[model samples]
Target: MKPFYIDYPQEKIAEHQHAYRCLHCKIPTTIIFGLLENHAKDCAYRIHQGRWTQLEASLKPIQKHFDEPHIDEVD
Candidate 1:
């Protein structure tokens, strides 16, 4: 089976979607499921209808798993 990363169709999403800036990382990112919707339940996000929100508000913790180091050993 393809890994989640492999399964995720980034090219399609990238061509048409906008991403919000991460509150903690200050990097452009999407509001991930479960993390924003559940785990960080108290957090808030400014979901603008027209365009991506600027890094004006220190709103919420968004997913950033791609930047994290792997648990397994790396060569």
Candidate 2:
């Protein structure tokens, strides 16, 4: 899964204030100072992050199957 980055403007960053917007949910949060805060606990985008991990885990078998070498059958 791709990492999520804060999309606050340059001026905001220069002023030490940030407005966090979730790319997936399109929700805008209040202005924050300094360190970045985590997304809302109930945000669907946040929930999807966990799902992405599960999805990758579930795909591991399929990935491995394609990665393994196959031998030709002889009659």
Candidate 3:
């Protein structure tokens, strides 16, 4: 897991020039501190990330044995 959830899209806070927050959840960056749980449960970023992780886990290739012979394709 990432130490921080900084990858989510951010929008500048209107009142503070330098302050930013999550675009979907509107939670301040300082408050979120990179933890996904800090974002709202229905946050768009969180929802997309959940599905992305699941897809990646399911798509992982199985490990092959070292003893397996290599086959070369004919030219």
lDDT of each: 0.33, 0.48, 0.86
**Residue 39 in candidate 3, Cα distance off native in Å:** 0.8
lDDT of 1: 0.33
Candidate 3 local lDDT, 1-75, one digit each (tens):
455667999999999989999999999999888888888899999888878777887898988778655687354
lDDT of 2: 0.48
Total backbone collisions, model 3: 2
Candidate 2 lDDT score at position 51:
76
Stronger candidate by lDDT (1 vs 3)? 3
Report the number of the highest-lDDT candidate: 3
List, residue by residue over 1-75, the lDDT tens digit for candidate 2.
Answer: 445434433222233356444544444544322213355566565666667667988887653345544587454
Give the per-residue lDDT digits (tens) of candidate 1, residues 18-62.
544445323334544313322133323323311122343335467
- Order of all candidates by TM-score, from best down to worst? 3, 2, 1
Q: What TM-score goes with each of the models?
A: 0.16, 0.33, 0.67
RMSD in order of candidates = 17.1, 8.4, 5.9
Residue runs of model 3 more than 4 Å from their true location after superposition = 59-75
| After superposition, candidate 2 runs with Cα above 4 Å error | 5-20, 23-37, 61-75
- Give the winner by TM-score: 3
